[model samples]
Target: MTNTAPSLVLPEISSARLTGLLEFLQSAEQLKDTLRSGTTANGRPESTAEHSWRLALMVVLFEPELKDIDLLKLLKLALVHDLGEAISGDVPAPLQTPGDNRQERERRDFLTLCEPLPADIAEELLSLWDEYAAAVTAEARIAKAFDKLETMLQHVLMPRQEASFYAFNLGYGVDRTDCSPLTRQIRDKVDGLTRALMEDAGRESA
Candidate 1:
């Protein structure tokens, strides 16, 4: 019978599990529609998904400098850091208040989103999200720092908004971004860009 290559076999996955996975992914598509406060160079409101994608790319580009950190974990943290925004949407940074319950709300939404996923997969993702929310691990901390930097970079590069918009970024997440010397240096560079943009906006309004 020529041994038939030892009869290849593959593990079976229940159809229900497969369906749940696909449903979860379909729900995640909402992220593509959740608009953030930042605009593109062309002045279109940027989506949360777009911001997350760029955040991941930023981490990959700086992987060489992010010594002793797990690159894969950093990327996952970046991607899912805002995944909950898909449901409740992003509250504009300027409107956010101290003790606003934003983090709690987002975590609830994240847990709901993972409900359709396999238990093991859901737990793993929840752990990552929780770590990022807490900024507990080195990977989580770096991801948080880059998250702030990426938002600052976007604000500065996008078409000029009101001077207040640029100013808002100057003081946005200093504590988070100040986690490391390199992150502080990057924040300073973005702050410089933000100042130039603020000036340009001021000139226009003058």
Candidate 2:
């Protein structure tokens, strides 16, 4: 028999990993998506990674318009908004998916992962996450509005597409009649982006 040392079983997410955890942010951060499918816009459906990237871009582009609000903080707030998805994954919209209870489940999972994290960072992320979900504060409201608007943008970006991004029609994919004025403004800004995609992509382009 050969003499050998047994492998040590490690606990969840060691300190080294915790220090480097931000790298995990780039992985597939979206849910309510498919493995090999295009978006309602003909562009590939956004993974959670793309979603955050787009949101960051939006915040930068729109910050000048938001003269009254503290946009830098809002951008930081929006940036980490979906990291919880690393644990729970994303669900497209609340209505279409059933019984996942994603927010609660993901929160629990993240809380566990927070153990190895520095206290302040973990608390800040959790607070930002809750703020996004609440949509109560001005920054949170603005962030949430863009979040919804971006999802809708995918719908109108494709004309010939059958439109199955979600179960509901939402009646005029670009409509934001019920959303707040800030959200509507964000829609106005991104509206041209979708149009540009349609014009450029024609039928298909990644």
Best by TM-score: 1
TM-score of each: 0.91, 0.64
TM-score quality measure for candidate 1 = 0.91
The local distance difference test score of model 2 is 0.60
Candidate 1 lDDT over 50-80, as tens digits, reads 9999999999899899899999999999999
The models' CA-based lDDT, in order, is: 0.92, 0.60
lDDT string, candidate 2, 1-206, tens digits: 98698978986876676664653343323322322122544455556656666777878887777767778768876777776666666665534356667778867765665555566767877888787777677787777766667666655554544323222334333333235666666566665555554455544533
Candidate 1 regions with alpha-carbon error over 4 angstroms: 1-12
* Candidate 2, superposed: residue stretches over 4 Å from native: 1-43, 94-100, 163-179, 185-206
Quickly count the clashes in candidate 2: 3
Model 2 clash pairs are 29-48, 30-48, 31-90
How many residue pairs clash in all the candidates, one count each? 0, 3
